[model samples]
Target: MSRPRRLLTLGHSYVVGTNRRLARAMAQAGAGEWEVTAAAPAAFPGDLGPITLQPEAGERVVPVSVHGAGRIHTMRYGPELRDLLRQEWDVVHCWEEPFIVSGAQVAAWTPRGAKLVFATFQNLPKRYPPPFSWMERYTMRRADGWIAFGRLVAEVLGARGIYDRRPHRVIAPGVDTTLFRPDRDAGARIRSSLGWMDDAAPVVGYLGRFVPEKGIETLMAALDGCAQPWRALFVGGGPLEAEVRAWAGRYGDRVRIVTGVAHDAVPDFVNAMDLLCAPSRTTRRWHEQLGRMLTEAMACGVPVAGSDSGEIPFVIGDAGLVIPENDVAAWTREIDALLASPQRRADLASRGRARAEAEFALDVVARQHLDFFDNLLMETR
Candidate 1:
């Protein structure tokens, strides 16, 4: 048999082990057909703190030093990456935005024979300024293909005519089903730990950054208007933490706000919820890219309710409830309707879990990536 195709994937977010699940999944899914290696920053500043490279099983990961570590647009990998890029490979996949300086560097260094693919989650259509725009143009000129993390991204970039004739695919990010599956015991444990031993009221949860753009105020108002007896659990930390805490104070023990949660522990909190809400509000510059938390909740057998902002509706896709982004009354009515009937919640939970397994599971997503790569390689050959 001919030698297996070698693949190299580079991303800054790979510093976190959980985020490297895609690389691991690719390696496993492509076994005997492809050889995979991932290059990540040795250490990078994260929202909670500095994140050190954490390698997972069944995959090869290289930790290279980086300059301007946390600055997405400005950071550049050290000489080690340049040296690695010189090596022969069938494909070089970049997880950075094409408009960033590092992306330009990768595009410039990739071997001539290799297929280069860049992944992006940018859904907005604003024209970037100066060097960023220059970098995007340069990178796209050399790219063999690109991957958009959501449909919105593909539509936005496609409209700009940047990918006119190039092959591109819309692939959503994957979630580890094994790590995020339903566990009644785990849910009970989390609720008990949070002093919610009674379990009499259904717990409504939010699992993302506590920012204004996340529609925290809208969520608060909707919950206040909820006629049904419900408990709220907010898992994540951001600039709006103080505001969230102050808002939760009025509810006494009906609300809980958790901060600095590790990625692995996320499933426990998710399982604790009867329903998950993603109330992201679109702003001038930003919109919900994928709403990863939606998949996680669905994977945990928890129903979800999301706003119509950006990709939320697409991600939910009839599996769960979709409310208006900033419509307090709509959110209140929908949330109340779900909370009023366990039968409805159970139906949504079942559908959501099925959707997660079929569309968002790691193995499913990994196979999609491999198929796309296989097609790209075949076209070139």
Candidate 2:
């Protein structure tokens, strides 16, 4: 009798819940051939506990601290991650852009006979300082396979002269279709909860960090230009929360700012929105990676409007509106147009839902990941 192939996935983003979704999906797909263990932060983002998505019997979540997203210094994880790497395994997967040194540490511990697969969401190539650059190079060289969220990520790598013979797959991180699908009644329920009863006014949503790179100021400026009736929903927390609150406050009873909603509640927020905006702008430090909210809103059959930053256009793919990055005038025009045209909005909604189902469904990408891992293992054998 042969032992099951062991798969270990390490990430700090597991707190966001999507990582756990992928972990669970992978566990199900690899049932006969593999055993999967996921290692993530003991405390989820916002100091939340373990995810609502409980592990199946025998599958496990090894709680550990994985920090260092914004800090210039390298991240730190517990010793369990280090000791576990010494054991034999078929695959060690690290789901962080190599720019972060923690990924390098994970790759460095890859067992002699095991394969190291690293996933990256960095659409823009970054030039790092000495030790970090060296560590990033080390991790890239060690990877047996690369999974990127978009084609531009590979272009960024190629432009930086980072090359390897190993296979690479451009796969969007999957969204749970069951959790984020369209519901005809969800909008009414959500709107009513927000005291927006019987209001037929257009609702635009922004569901990410209140950070500058998100271009929230531009969104606010565009909304300020609106002459027609429109409501805005802001659903996240970050450094600029105060500014965001003030912006929402100007709208008085029309705007809703929701913080600390569970992952499961995200769909309801999306449903309440007539349009979802991901108006990210490219800065030297960051660009929109996947515009995950765009896809989530799409899954909920809500039309989206994104800026021409990073992979937003690629992800949208004609399903929704794509305006010039940081162009408030363009955002204003598009928002007004979409709000007035019900048929056009419906058309976009239908197309966006189709695109999400086809391109970003959890099971579809999970199978792609399983296939990629299987092929890499086969090649090594």
lDDT agreement with native, every candidate: 0.92, 0.83
TM-score of 1: 0.98
Which candidate tops TM-score?
1
Q: List the lowest-lDDT window of 10 residues for candidate 1.
A: 157-166
**What is candidate 2's lDDT per residue for 264-351, written digit by digit as tens?**
8899889989899999989887878899999899999999999999989999998999999988999999998898888999999999
Q: How well does each candidate superpose onto the true structure, as a TM-score?
A: 0.98, 0.91
Query: How many clashes in each structure?
Result: 0, 0
Q: In model 1, what lDDT does residue 97 have?
A: 89
* Residue 337 in model 2: lDDT: 89
Clashing pairs in 2: none
lDDT: worst 10-residue window of model 2: 45-54
Off by over 4 Å in 1: none
